[model samples]
Structure formats: C-alpha cells, structure tokens
Target: MGQQTVNEPPVVEGPATQEFAPEVEKLINTVAKFTVLVSQKLPDDVAARLKELAEEETAPMAKMIYSTMARNQDLAWQLKRPSCQDTGLVQLFVRAGTDFPYLDRVDAAMKEAVARATKWSPLRLNTVETFDEYNTGTNTGSRSPWIYWQTIPDSDSLELDVYLAGGGCSLPGQGKTLMPGEGYEAAVKFVLDVMTSYGINACPPLLVGVGIGSSIDAAAYMSKAALMRPVGSHSANPKAAELETELKDAIDRIGLGPQGLGGQHSVMGVNIENSARHPSVLSVAVNTGCWSHRRGTIRIASDLSYELLTHKGVEL
Candidate 1:
C-alpha cells in the first residue's frame, strides 16, 4: 500500500446528498468494472508466486503444467477474459469506516456492481435459489453475492477483499467442533484428515486456511477469512505460525502437486486465523482455495479515488 494518501471530501452523516447521488453511482460503476477485471486478471502476488513455483519444480511434467498455467494467465490478461470457466461465487469482505458519508448507499452500490459484472464480466451463472432451483442469470438472488461487512472505529475509506470461491473449493469446506479435551492437536488431525480425503478434489497447490474459534460458524468464517491473506503470510501468533509451516510441509509431502497430477508440492501455503475460544468448545474449520487462487484487495477513498491493492496497472 502506498503511503501517499488523499484527504477525502467532507462527510455527510444522514445520507448521501442528492448532489452526490451521481457521484455515488460513478463509484458503483467503477467498482463494477474492477469486479470484472479481477475475475479476468489474476492478482500480481499470486502470479508471481506461481511463476516462482514453476521455476522451482523439478519434474518435467509438473514444470510443463506450470508453464501452461503461466500461459493461461498471460492469455487471460491479454484477451481480457476469465482464465477459468468457473468465474465462481463472489464473496466480498468490506471494511467501511463509521465516518464514511455513503454508508446507506454501500449495499446498493455493491449489488449493482455484482449485477453489472455478471453481464460485462460475463460471469457464469453460479447462483440458484434453494428448492426452486433455477439460475437467476443475474447472480443476485437470496444473498447470492455474499457481502461480509465490518465497520471500523474511525476511518473514511472502504476496503474490500474480493474472493472467487469456485465450486471445487467451496464444496470441500469442512468444519467441526472439537471437545476441549480434544485440543489443538485434534484440530490439526481433522485438517489432515480432510486434506487426505478431499484436498485433491479441489485444485492442488491449495492455500489451506485453518480457523479456530468458539463456535463452528465463527471458525468457518475465520477459515474463509484466512484465505484472504497473502499466500506466504502466516498468523501473528508464533504457535499458529509454526503450525502453519509444519502443516504446509506435511501436506505438500502428500504430493498432490499442481492440478493434482503429482509433483513435489501439494500446497502453495497454509494460513491459520484464530479467535478467543471457549474453554469447553474448540471449533475448527478448513477452507481450501484453488491453485488458481482468485482473491484481491481494493480500497475506495471517500472522494471516490481508487486503488487496486493486489493487482498492478489497474485504473479506476
């Protein structure tokens, strides 16, 4: 992130003024465009890491697969098209400041952004209402494009983490509540069990996010949140960070490799995110991000200036 910051315009508490409505709409349109762009373009950090992995791989078949992946990334950027057919289920985590002027308009702006991206990004129709079972085509049905929000104590900017959770990865998300006596050791066992059983079903070189919290839902949310972290980033807690390294090494030994064809490594990395847990309940959850890991961060200034934090050469 750049230290150079812009002073946002004055904040209007109650609602965005009529004069600002069009400006707000402009912000929505810009978000819509970037939403589409992100699906088409892999983030810079991920691309760089993949390249490094490719160069390090020793097996000829594995190296060739990695080269093909690089070509796919290049072609996607060149043609401005999605690299994967599963454009995925969109999940947005937003950190909005309390002092921000357009709080009331955020939901509408984001919803419009998703809708517009469906057409312009040509996102696959991944949403369908339960029971009724028909694609909305618009990608806006019953919280189809899920948005998780957090309001900051005192800030005016809006920060977002966008995730494309494809069916392969989403289908394998695992959660369990372990008894206190089961301990963190059991939690690690559960993750290992899940990966051994189903990790390869999702793409390999997976980014494994382990969540430990008081309840299953809390653990699950933290697990997904962990996927937002950069590939090589580890938890601040020394114990957690150490466990991340251990687990990554252990899992990569399974040799699922890139796209599960067999290679030197099974995972890109492991990340653990935790919260204060109940003495009686130790809930653990695991969320696996695909090898083509589609995740990005963006910041929107109060004055509507934008920054694509996870990608380069993006304009808004």
Candidate 2:
C-alpha cells in the first residue's frame, strides 16, 4: 500500500477442450486394440468353415496344405500373434452424423490411432508411396489410412468399418464401362467370366462385391462398398437383391470352394451396389474378398459415444 506497486494479473490455463466425445475416444482406442487382436485370432466360424473345407476338399495336396493352415491359425491365435505374415492395409469406412462433435478432427484422430495400432499391434508396414517407394513403417502416411465418408441424417453418432485388406484379396478389383446397349445381362456375364477365370486365384469361398452404374470409377467404388455388406446380406433393391442371390448361387455352382481346391461353396456370399447412370453407358465393377474376410465396424453418436458393429460385445 505504501509503495503502491502495480502488478500484472497472472495467466491462468483453462481445461483442455475435448474435440470428441469421451465415449468416442474410448471406442477408438478399443478398435485399435481389437484390430490387433483380430489379426491374431481367427474367429470360430472361420475356423469351422476352414475345417469343413479341409475335410471336403478333393485335392489331396491342397487338403494337406489347408490342414497345415488351420493348425497354424490355431497356433497363432493361441500365441496372440498375427494369423498371416502380411497384416495388410487398413481401410476405414466412416458414416458420421452432421452434428458429430469431433467431425473436423475425426480423420486425423483415426490416422493417429492407426499409427498407434501399428506400433502396439506391431502391424506390418504395408503403405508405400507409389512413385517414391518410401515405406511408412508406421502403417500411415499421406492418405495412408484410407477413409470413405458418408453423412448420416438425423443421427448423433458415427459408424466406422475397418478392413484389413490383403494384397492378394484386393488384386481382383476390376471394372469396365460398356455401351448401354450391351445390357445388364452382359454385365452379369462379364462378372461370371471374371470369376471363372481368376476367382480361383482370389482364395474362395469369396465374398463377391459387384457395382453397377454410369462410369467405370463410380462402379469400381460401389463394388468395394459391396464388400462391406455382411456375409449373406443382400441389396435393399429387390432386383439388385435378386441379382445378388442369383450370382451367389452361380458362383457357388462354380465349385471353386475354399482355397480353390474345389467344393460346394465357391463363395460364402455376394453383394451388389448400384447407381443411376447415363443413358448411353453401363458401368460394372467387381471386387473380391478372401475366406479370411477380416473387417470390423463401429458406430458413434453425435455426442461421440460409439458402438462396434462387426465384432459384437467389443467396447472402446
């Protein structure tokens, strides 16, 4: 009081802003942990199917190899290690609500989660720049965590589907734009032809995803989307759903079976994705999934709370 000294106010820090819901943050971490766990564990259904195929396989050598594979998968799961040497590329399909709280930072957070998962799960460094050939040992780089986005109306949460797509399985994606006059029959025939020719190499009991639309690129994208449908799920459109069933039947009749050793189940399922197209053009695309069929999905609320769709009972 006597000196009347002037003192400046002290700077105070506020609490950190939470861009995402606590539930969402928890879910993301859970997914990251499960991704590694799933890579190591072959689900019971998959194991049983493989066993049935091994027993039914006519090719003696193929059966023997398949038996060995089943044994290896069992060992890997028991040991908590990756089922296959190639952990594959991580791809995420995200359906987010417009009202999602952490909408802006969701993608960035996902990329960081992938990187962390790669280190914690010790995922294979699969991403490499096409021209530069730089391996991003962390399983992430520019666009390394591939994401497909959709805005869900009137919802408060987000849904995420993750796929660990192996190079062998993804190699079969193909599309062609045909003259409209070529007709839907022609498209169906083309799909069959592709399967008959290369389906064996793709590792059957395949999940067949077909896309039909205006342009080759659009169709190609739809085809990949079809792969996200659950096994035995059909398109919502009646005609499209019928096509899925028919195609599944036709493919199964091919007798390619599990591992292409030949059996009753050439494909486990088929799904079709379609779009309205220009009058003059008909585009068709096809993508295949191997028997391993490794994929996981999660849904989050606008408030950032989430649910894991693919692997039931899994919490984040």
Candidate 3:
C-alpha cells in the first residue's frame, strides 16, 4: 500500500481560544493611559467657552476664578497630570456585538487595564466598600469599576465609552416621580430648580442631562444617559430638542459661569433622554457634568483592532 500522508487539522479561532494580538492589547493599554491624560486636559471647546466667559464675566471674583481655571487647565495639560485630584470613579459603557471574538474577555481586559492604569497613571483609589469604608487601592473590586453592557445583533465590533464622574458633579444628581398629570412642564420646573440651586456648585458651563419616564430609577438612569451625549448634540425628537435648547439658554442666563464664580455662560449645553412612562406616573431625573468633563470612547473590531471616538484623531 502506498504510504498515507496525514494532514494536521486546520486551526480555528473561537471566543475561548482567540487571543488579542500584541498591538491590539497595546491599544487597550493605551486607552487606559489616554483616559488619565484626557481627564487632566479639558477639551478645547470647553476651554474656549471658559475664556469667553472670563472676558464677559461681570463679577470680578468670578472672572478671576475663571482665569485661574483656564490657567490651571493649561498647566495640567502641560504637566501631564490629573486636573482634579479626585479623578472620580471610572465607568465604562460598552456596546458589544455577540460575534465579537473578545466579547467574553473584554470585562477582564478592562479590569486589568484599570489596575495597570492605577499603577502607571496613579489614578485615585476611589472604590470604597460603602459599609466597610475600605479602599480597594487598585480600583478593581466587586462593582468597583462600573460597566454597562448592551448587546448588538449581527455586528462585528464593540464600542466602549469611558466616563469619569467626579463627586461634586455627581452630587447634584437628582430624580423624582410625579403624577402623569404633572406633564413635561413639571419636569422642566424640577430641572430649573435643581440648576438654580445646585448648578453653581457643579461648576457652570455644565452639561445638563435630563431623563423623563416612569419610575424614579428609570428616570435617573436615563438622566445619566443624557450625560453621555456630545456637548452640542440635541435630542432626536423635535419637542425634546427644543426643550434642550431652551434650557441651555435659561441656564446661560443664570450666570453661574465657569467654576460657579459667575460669567456669561452658565451651561455648555443641555441634553434630554426620554422614555415612555406609565399612565399614572411620570419620572424626571437630572445629572450634571463639571467644567473638567472627562470622558473617552473607543470602538474595537471583531479582529481586536480599535478606534478612539471621543478625542478626534487620537490613535491607540
């Protein structure tokens, strides 16, 4: 009989067996590094708005404060350090496709990246057990790194948004349930009240996020969703978009301008996210972003290649 040659089976890459390439892994690490970097450097648009406010600000103290903020932002970027010592807690909003090769391991990779970042970038250890009051030091523990996941169908890539929520900015987060009859006007009033009182404290030229729906929790979650919006973006619905614009103008008139010292700009913009509510109840929630708004986004392909979305043209 002729000698039979044996052929090795073809290699297959599955979710369990696939590994991210060296460059891809490096990209993930780079994201963590950039997260720390951007947290220190306010966006150009934000900085420009602050400058305008400083020029137009009538309050001497507020003008001086705005000038100091602008200077501090410049220095923080030049020094490549965190603008705020708190650095806040890290939150990741991930939209992953079921077919993405690294979907299963993305969470692990993120946790690892965060830990590496803590050591390399020196991010503050903000994760403390509520009851125990013990800091994790590494910023990675049970739910210490907040992640929100959404699965998309028939997609081959994953999109990740990183948000750093500071204590002061998050402190003004408020939500309430109202009777359906209260309608949108009531919701608007609630937001106005919050901004008039706590908005100054949140560091004006704030990005206001409003959520409207049923249930206090749902409204609150929607409000946070609003914060994910781009500075100048508006709602899809015409009415909602109009409300956003109106609120923005009203806030600017508040003169809470940069760092709450008072200026021409009280808010950078306003965004609203709404959902269908129960017949009997309507809920509204609000959250604010400080002047030093820190957020970044990246999208990864099925092959583990990625793109940075938040800071335009940023590679890795």
Q: Who wins the lDDT comparison?
A: 1
Clashing pairs in 3: 205-266
Candidate with the larger lDDT of 2 and 3: 3
lDDT of candidate 2 over 252-309, digit per residue (tens): 8888866777677787678899999999999999999887777766666665455556
Residue-by-residue lDDT tens digits, candidate 1, 128-196? 767666676667667757999999978998898878888998766999999769898899899999998
C-alpha lDDT of residue 11 in model 1: 34
The order of the candidates by lDDT, greatest first, is 1, 3, 2
Looking at model 3, report the run of 10 residues with the lowest lDDT sum. 8-17
Per-prediction TM-score to the true structure, in the order listed: 0.92, 0.83, 0.86
Query: How many clashing residue pairs appear in each of the predictions shown?
Result: 0, 8, 1
Better of 2 and 3 by TM-score: 3
Q: After superposition, how far is residue 302 of candidate 3 from its true place, in Å?
A: 2.6
Task: Please give the TM-score that candidate 1 achieves against the real structure.
Answer: 0.92
As a TM-score, model 2 comes out at 0.83
